[model samples]
Target: MNAFRTTRWSLIAAARDSPSRAQAALDQLCQAYRPPVLAFIRHSGYGNDAEDLTQAFFLRFIERGWYAEADPQRGSFRALMLTALRRFLSDQYERAGALKRGGRTVESGSLLEVIASDGQSPEDAFMRAWMGTVLEHAMQRLEEEWSSAGKLDQFRQLAPLLLERAEGDELRAIAVANGLRTNTLAVQTHRMRQRLRQLVRLELLQTVGSPEALERELAELRGALDEMT
Candidate 1:
């Protein structure tokens, strides 16, 4: 019922409606999440090849319609992405001499350098991966909640317009579309905003191991979104 949960559910519902759009949304989500994923891959000790492989895994997720298989009832999006990443790494390890090699010449810098820029240890890298997994799960929960409530369709139609227009214009449009009075629409919008915040907090609760961890994780989530902007 928090903002994060609402956003997460909205996205899941959107994804369920259209795979292409879902992928686009997922790509946007990944931009916030990729650094941690990359750090995990690097800490696991794969070379730059592994980094490229990690990027390719995301690309494949879209190209193959991977999100279509995501089931919020079964598990979280965070678990799914990390599971896929682990599988990809496992398959790559099976390739000839993949694990035996030292640093082979890569186009970009070493994966380790990318992951350990601030003297980060392998444990730090692992924590990053854990965080990414947690956030992804939170997103999935939000999506499921919205889809169940059947407001996802309305949200999708109005989100872009509302984001662009002034409050009066947005209220007018929403009121007309939903067959509500302007005052009623305004109240609905306020409720919707409240729901979004609640959803976000719910998601944050699931991701962080404890209440003390929530503040830091929330800050990181905000920072990740800011980076996208």
Candidate 2:
């Protein structure tokens, strides 16, 4: 298993065994999930202060050791994170309302009126963002791997086909353009897809506690991505 996958509950253990290593793991997770966190906050009507709020939320999360309460048996890390973020936003809203009641001026733009035009809850929006980010990171790692092997151009040309359907004629055209046989191109694309799946699983594994949880998360990821299409 990758050192990065030794996170979540393992991270809490690390805090006891090695605080520095645990902190590094926490930082990596925060960076990876920042986009989804921001999406949730913005969708919750904190668009104006999303950046500051995200930063502060992360600071509080880490400084207060809130993640120490994460129990793998209860749920995946993603669930734990979303729950914490929702609570944080609720507290922020309550604080602003209290200030207003106390005759303190709360910035008008601090909390915009939530307009969920798509009828998507903030939780749903956050999951979509998380799914997208996972794929983005997986693709990035795929590119780096192929690039290091001197096949960056091949990876680039075939990457789109990995995620989208292409007719036989189109596949042949792509193969011919690259001076390769259609069958060979098909094999290469299959390999690429397999590699991508492995990378995506690795990415998801960091947030899961066990193999069962990993499978569950991967299924959820696939379902979420399918919904997007």
Candidate 3:
């Protein structure tokens, strides 16, 4: 059921419904992928123009109603989005200089900021931005879950264990501060990791069109993580 709950279909349905109801899902999809798309544009050598192009690209993609007719069966949403982005860039490149990019700009130091300036490959920059945004999505959800449960501080204490390597001394100190034994802290961190894993999968599920596709994406995600290390 989660497979079809993908934003690909949601945006499609929203488009078919009415313009007013369509923006929410469309906005969500655009916002989730914006960082990577912007990174791609940045690495393509647009520099200061990437931010403007990012907004313009999204506005074109949605306002043009391209996604409403997009066939998710033809390809993954990731592939489709990238393809759309490339097309947007190609069409806009010649006009970029003439387009006047003085509109809204990206804030200070986003994931895509200075990606191209850092001597990173376009593919690497895009992947870094993609993974970063996905992790941000999952972290935000976990934070919300903990906040809703009134365990935000506990989650904060354990979050580092899941997302980053916490030193043994630090973990033990956290345990002592939280009134938990070392073993109890270990168990809680394990549970929190499990929850984080589930949330990550949930985020991935939204990007896939089917259960089989989701499984394939999950396998690719693991491979990507492995390669990152």
Rank candidates by lDDT, best first: 2, 3, 1
Q: Model 1 scores what on Cα lDDT?
A: 0.59
Please say which candidate is ahead in lDDT: 1 or 2.
2
Instruction: Tell me the spans in candidate 1 whose CA falls farther than 4 Å from its real position.
Output: 1-19, 96-124, 129-229
Per-candidate alpha-carbon RMSD to the true structure: 11.4, 2.8, 5.3
Local distance difference test scores for all models? 0.59, 0.80, 0.74
Clashes of each: 19, 0, 0
What's the lDDT for residue 186 in model 1? Answer: 67
Determine which window of 10 residues in candidate 3 has minimal summed lDDT.
Answer: 104-113
lDDT by residue (76-188, candidate 2, tens digit) is: 87887888898898889899989989999988668766645776667778999998888898999999999999989888889999999789999999999889999999988
User: What is the C-alpha lDDT profile of model 1 across 1-229, one tens digit per residue?
Assistant: 3433444435555666777686776666667567767776776665656667667777765666555666544544455566776766566555433534654543333333344455555435645565555545544554566679897876665444422444787668777888888887667666655655566566655433345555665776567555544
Error of 2 at 42 (Å): 1.0
C-alpha TM-score for every candidate? 0.43, 0.85, 0.82
Highest TM-score scorer: 2
- What is the C-alpha RMSD, rounded to one decimal, of candidate 3? 5.3
Best by lDDT: 2
